[model samples]
Target: MNIRPSAAIRQNYNEIADMCRKTGEPVFLTKNGEGDLVVMDIGTYNRREKMLKLREELLAVEEDRMRGSKGYSVEEVTAMMRNAIREAEGHGTAE
Candidate 1:
């Protein structure tokens, strides 16, 4: 998602420094004999990096279940549900 450009990032030098402190994101700047480009903290740069990790995890789980991953018995699943409900109700333990 594109963040809106600040007036300083658009207007002044000190603005980039001030805004970087607040947003943890960089702004754009132009150098002498150069053109417009973004400026930002390395931390923000690293965090903005993306990967397919989430998709890979979901696909792995689906493949395992389809290929006969061990199944739990109904009694075991029912006990787990009862335990979760008891926890949600703020009780100390489930019977």
Candidate 2:
């Protein structure tokens, strides 16, 4: 993990920012020998948020399945995807 003293932010802001951008990872900043803050580039932060959202959605779906909610079959899902692709391509209407 990338780690830096809190003072590094004030002393080497540009270098830290460059490292975050280059590595696509957060830099852990510590204050008084304890974790203080995390620094990451905007793109990495956004991607992380998207991934977390996706995981949450998947978990909800799994919970629904566990509770006996209806699930789509493989063929049904395939057809739905094809229909969506066609609609996106302006060749079909929403069902």
Question: TM-score for each prediction?
Answer: 0.32, 0.80
Please report the TM-score between candidate 2 and the true structure. 0.80
lDDT (Cα, tens digit) per residue for candidate 1, span 21-56 = 678866655455344567776666666653356667
lDDT of 2 by residue, 40-86 (tens): 99999999999999999999999999999999999899889989998
Report, for all candidates in order, the number of backbone clashes: 2, 0
Q: What is the C-alpha RMSD of each candidate to the true structure, in Å?
A: 7.8, 2.4
Give the residue spans of candidate 1 off by over 4 A.
1-62
True-vs-predicted CA distance for residue 5, candidate 2, Å: 0.8
Global fold similarity of model 1 (TM-score):
0.32
